[model samples]
Target: MLDIRPIGRSMLNKVPEVTLVFWLIKIMSTTVGETGADYLAVHVGLGTSVTGLLMITLLAAVLAIQLRMDRYVPWVYWLTVVLVSIVGTQITDALTDKLEISLYVSTAAFAIALAATFAIWFSVERTLSIHSIVTQRRELFYWAAILFTFALGTAAGDLATEALGLGFNVGVVAFTALIAAIAAAYALGANAVLTFWLAYILTRPLGASFGDLLSQAREYGGLGFGTIYTSLAFLTVIVALVAWLSFEADAGGKPEASPGA
Candidate 1:
């Protein structure tokens, strides 16, 4: 059974700690996001509209559970992320594929929206730091920013790989390099919060490109692993990691408290 119970903790931050495992799972989740969305929409024959509606409904339910929680719960947090990824991908695909909007236009629009969200969030909270998510309002702002990031990432990724003709292999490498540069900057004393968000955004495209490399046919410069296998492989790893995190939390691990702005 899904445990929706809130755990005892001193702080109210509802996000996981920034760690290597966190990034590992995040990248894989994006991979699953790309492939999973494709599988359900195309291969499963639900079509994009039906897939989008189904995923949105599921995301609403999971997000409600997440909002009700008083503190971070690994499973809940990750589940919300996965659903958001799917919904985000669907949002981008709808605009680009159905509405026939230019990728450049969608990318810029999402970017402006994300910047506006951050501006409003910081104007109200005085902090754009994830470490300060101790209130419901801040958490809401965080999720809003996250949703935009995923959508922006999807549009940007598709623009680069498909529209720009970079292809999957080069897309993965370019995004990976960009993230590495960001990490190096952070290590050299850049703002932690900014670096974190930058990396988080890039990882989505990097993972998506990697997913395509594995799932697409060899003629398309991919390995032909197929969407089902690619999604399943990444999802298995995600589930195992979440299980471990939950076990540790249940064993009385006091997660890091929310830091002040």
Candidate 2:
């Protein structure tokens, strides 16, 4: 287990504490990512290509700001995450939709990419723990892993639903159960870092499945809430959560740093 402590009064960690709120916001951000990308691409008439470019540009700008920050800033960090989620979805969409790549191919490719990233990161840093993401290099690895997880999750979710005919709600239940099992294992002394990453990866697909369940048409297995409303509603909640975190930070409440880097 990681030791919850303030690393220093002067130097705060780069990532937020892994709390319930962190997971909540993460799931919500991913949901918004799926629907937001679709909203801009389809509803706004931007198309996938143009939306991809725009979102990538925005992600780059936000990531630059996040990298420049000295410590964890909730709004900036979550904004970068939201943008990354959107761009990640667009990346998989390009591969599968435009290039006509198979979901299985994309899923395998992304899994390999993520594994390579972890291998290189562990080789260079000697650790794959998120709690130790205090340097630029580790942060780079962290974000890269996050991007790949989103792409992989998008592909996996689509593979289960569209390819395997699992349907959106079923995918949600499946991923949710998997995550619960992981959590239970963690509680029973499984590797914390490994379990954390597994849960993180799983959350992407879980959230995406739920996003589709809400935004997709009833005929297509969703509840009939359009992409626009779903995206907006989730975005609103994300903003509120981030705002509260920012306020808490300003009030001298800092997230505890996990030990055992």
Off by over 4 Å in 2: 1-11
* Cα TM-score of candidate 1: 0.94
**Backbone clash count, each prediction separately:** 0, 1
Q: Clashing pairs in model 2? A: 3-259
- TM-score: model 2 vs. ground truth: 0.94
- TM for every model, in the order presented, reads 0.94, 0.94
Tens-place lDDT per residue, model 1, 1-261, is: 554343222347788888888899999989998999999999999988999999999998998889778889999999999989999999999999899999999999999999999999999988888877777788889999999999999999999999999999999999999999999998888888889889999998999999999999999999999999999999999999999999989998847753322
Please give the CA lDDT of all the candidate structures. Answer: 0.90, 0.90
Model 2, span 1-261: residue lDDT tens: 323233232335789988889999999999998999999999999999999999999998888888777689999999999999999999999999999999999999999999999999999989999888877777889999999999998898889888999999899999999999999998888898899988988998898999999999999999999999999999999999999999999998785876632
